[model samples]
Structures are given as structure tokens and as C-alpha cells.
Target: MDPLSEVLSLLKLRSYVSGGFDAAGDWAIRFGPHEGIKFHAVVAGSCWLSVEGELPVQVNAGECFLLSRGLPFSIASDLSLDPIHVSQVLPPNPSGRILSYNGGGDYLSIGGHFTLAEGQADLLLQVLPPLLHVRDQLGSATLRWCVERMRQELAEGQPGDFIVAQQLATIVLVQALRFYLSGRKAENPGWLFALADKRLCAAMAAMHATPGERWTLQTLARVAGMSRTAFAVTFKGTVGLSPIAYLTHWRMMQAADHLVSSRCSLAEIGSAVGYDSEKSFGAAFKRVMRCSPREYGRRQGGKGGPMLRSGPTSSSTHTGG
Candidate 1:
């Protein structure tokens, strides 16, 4: 079974939203999740998205804030804003279609809400200021072109419009991730994918391929073709975690899944993950996931029925791109 199959980055989406203002002014949005990432893009209008405890971020039309690590933040017409709903205020002098959010049915099918009732445990919350907008920015040639095309497909409401809209939204989201990641300073990066370095994606590929191998910073630096110091700095800047820290986290996440899903014993699991002893394995697992191997196993077993791991269970599968 592919261990990486069930792993999805915290959050990712592309959306075409209506500019949240009536007047020729800007608006903003703030977002905070107890956990997970928040991402946003502006099709039209202008505003700033400020992370409360972090540095302030500014976004314009055709731009996005890929808050890779979820933080409590807000957006406003100017800085110092709170998340106000699109319906919060109407356009000051309405001559055009001034709606709080983008209009029409296709928006829902495209930007999501397509499977809200499908028991999707990973659904994003609706109450979010993580995404913001402005008035004049929406008039840009680039944004206008994208919005018009999306609107047309959604407006047509044809048989294949649903699929077409989702694909377009996904494209928009990818554009936002690129813009957000490109302009960040060293103080920030992803919270988990620390090995998600511009240069270190290759290093991660190495580790993922051989998680059972003994890894050292020096060796990793060689794989990255940099001095240890330069590799460390670049790796942390892009991934937001140290190399050793990232490896430990990835191992623990995988170990948790394996212990619960596979027939492997604690000793086997520990050895498979580069741990030489059960004690060392248990210690690492606790440090990362806050639970011991025995505790994790006990929790997975039913109170009274044939235990699942007593024999093999049906295998699960997923598709990857």
C-alpha cells in the first residue's frame, strides 16, 4: 500500500469571487482555523489580509495568500480589519451588479459546495474571512478575462459545466499558491513539509524513498548540493521545519497509520521506520503524535467483536496525480 496515498496538503482551492464592495474601494478578509491551512485569491477589488499574530500580507487582483500554515488572520478595506461577510455592506453607489459574492449557480458547483452533503470530513468551513476582495482590482484585464470565462460556463449551466468549473477553480488555486510562495521571506514557510524546499524537494524525494536509512544533515546537504548551513537555512525557509524535525514528523504520521492499519508489531514498525529499539521508537512516536504505540493500538480495537488486526482487513485504495 502507498503510505502517502491518504496524505493531502492541509487545504487547496481556486475560486472566482465577487468584489465585496460597491464603491470604487477595496475590502479585506481574515482567517483563522483551529488547525489546517487557509488559502485565498482575489479576482477583482483590492485589500490587505493581515494575520493577527504574524506579519501583515497585502493582496491585489490576480494575487493570492496561500496561508500554508493556518493562522488567525483577517482582511479589510485597509489594514486593521476583521472578517466581515460579503453581505455586510452594499456597494456605496450601485451602477453595476454589486453583490457580496460572485453571482449564479455555477459558482457553487465550481468553487465547491458540489459535495457538501457527501460526508466529506475534510470540508472547509464556510465562515471564513481568509479570502478577501476589492473593487478596482477586479477590472484588471487578467482577472476580468478569467472571471468572464468562469461566469459564462457557470451561466450556461450545461451538462458538463460542473466539471468545467471545478477544473477552472483548481487552476486559480494553483496560481495563488505560486504567487504566495514566491514572495515570502525566510521567517516563513510551510509548517510541516519542511523538506518542501526549492532545492530540497529532491532531498525529500530521497528521504521518502528511503525512510529506513540513517540520515544526517551532512548527507542531506550533499543530496541538496549545498553546504550544511546553506541547506539548513534554505530548507527551513521553504518548509518551516528543520530537516530532522520534518523527518521525525513524517515518520510518526506514517507510523500512526501503519500501527492502526497494518498487522505489523511494535518492534517491526519501529525497525521499518529507522528505529533500532522499541523504546526509542515509542519515545519518538510519543514526541510527535502525543501517544504511545500501545495506547494507539488499544484505541483502534473494538470493545467486543473480533479484533480487526487479528487477521487481515480489506485493503483501501486512493488515486494520486
Candidate 2:
């Protein structure tokens, strides 16, 4: 699998709620702080979206935005209007329905909230900005189609509509990330942004494809068709980590995934990720994950059995509406 696909798979997206709302003139809704990622597409008309800690954004027809940080936000036809909490307008349970407000019909939008596995979301979220706004001019055709399809699926409520909406929401999430990568420059120092550089992509792909391979700067540079010095400079500049550091981080991430998903012994997992000794693996895992492998597995309630009382784990939970 490619690096993006591999990382997403390891993150393990759990559930999603797909729904929308229609509103008329002079209205606003304040959505409280949420968990996971939230995405919205303006289907018709427009509104002002104000996410805490960020400037208010004007979302016009056919435009989409993603909230990666799960912050409090509000949407309004007019920002000055006194906004009501979302619970007052939408149902408590996400039923994939298009709700109406103030008699409806002036503005329309559809959205989806993705709830990823606790403790794994930061793998993706850390590389993303808090708010990603995809304009109509920023190659949003596929995203537009996905949003429209999701709107229809929610509105029509046909058989299998739930599954269809869920799939489309996933597609929207991926496409949004793709568009963000394509439209921006590689100035940002994150692995997600590094994919925009062809050379960095080659080296990263090699690391992801066979993480167990004992790789060095020279070998990875050769894979990227660059000298070792140039490769190191470029990799650090774009990915914000040295080549070996990134490799170790990726290995630990793979090991973490295995710890929760597989019944492999610690030695086997360590060897699979290029560590010859379980002690070395444990140390590396602790350095990167802030917890030992065994502790992590227990905290995650994986095959490692019941949770033992320990210091706080790095995992997080997102409860989306």
C-alpha cells in the first residue's frame, strides 16, 4: 500500500454521521465543541462559518470545508444573529436527515462527521491544519459530486442509504485531503505535505512499502535518485524529520497497530519492524508512543487482556454529532 493508505489504515477510522440542514433567512447555529473531524459542503446559497481560534470563513455554494481539530464553531446566514445550539435544531441522534429551520428553503448544506479510533487520530490530525477550506476553484469537482450524492442519499432515505452515505463521506474525506495537497505548496513541514514533492514521495514510499528493511541514508537517497546529503536536507526540510528518525517513527506506528490488531508476540512484532531485540523495540516504542508496547496494548484493550492502572495513555476519544 502507498504511505497515505497505510497510515489511514493504521489509524482505523471507526464511525461517521452523515446529515444536513436547510435554513431560511436570518439564522445561525452554534455547534459546541466536537470530537473527530467534521466536513461541510454548501449546496445552495451561502453562510459564514466561524471556527474558534480562526477567522470566520464565507462558504458559498459548492464550496466545502473541513474541521480537523474538533473545535467549537458556528454557521450563520448572518453572523450578527443570536445563534442557537445545534441540539435545538437537529435531532439528538444523527439520523442522516435533512432538518429544517425557520421554515427552511433559503440555504442548504450537507455534512459528515468522522469518528476515528481513539489514540490513532493524531497520526492524521497532526499533519493537518485545524481548518481546511476547499474553494470551488481549488479542484473540488469530485468533492462536489460526493457531497451532492451524500445529500441525495440522506434526503431520499432509500434502502441502503445509510451505507451509501457512509461510503461517500469517506470518499469526501480522502478527496478533500488530496485537493489540499494538490493546491498547496510544499512549504509546510509535515509528512502529508511532503507527498507533494516527487523525490520525497519516492523515498517515503520506499520506507512505507517495506518498513522492516534495514535502511540507511545512502540507500534511501539512491532510491530517490539523489545524493545522500541532498536527500537528507530535502527530507528534513519537507518532512520535518531526519530520514532515520522518520523510519523509526513509522516502525513504531506499525508496531502499535500490530499490538492492538494482531496476536503476535512482542519479539515477533519487534523483528517484523527491523528490531532484533524486544528491549530495543520496547524502548523505541516508548520513545515514540510515550508508553511501552505492553502498556499501550493494555490501555487499548487489545489482545493483551484487561486494562491495568497506569499513567495516562496518549489516546483520545471523539464524540461527533
Quantify all predictions' global Cα lDDT against the true fold.
0.50, 0.81
What ranges in model 2 sit over 4 Å off? 91-94, 302-321
Model 1 error, position 65 (Å)? 3.8
- Candidate 2 residues 62-133, lDDT tens each? 888899998999999988888899878776775668888888898999877888767668878888888998
lDDT of 1 by residue, 82-168 (tens): 466433444666322323443321111112211111111132332123432222232244434554455566556567654565555
Model 1 regions lying over 4 Å from their true place: 1-40, 45-60, 66-153, 160-171, 189-198, 227-242, 259-268, 276-279, 294-321
What are the RMSDs of all candidates, in order? 9.2, 6.6
lDDT of 1: 0.50
TM-score of each predicted structure versus truth:
0.55, 0.91
- Candidate topping TM-score: 2
Predicted structure with the largest lDDT when compared to the true one = 2
- Candidate 1 residue-wise lDDT at 94: 37
Number of clashes in every candidate structure? Answer: 16, 0
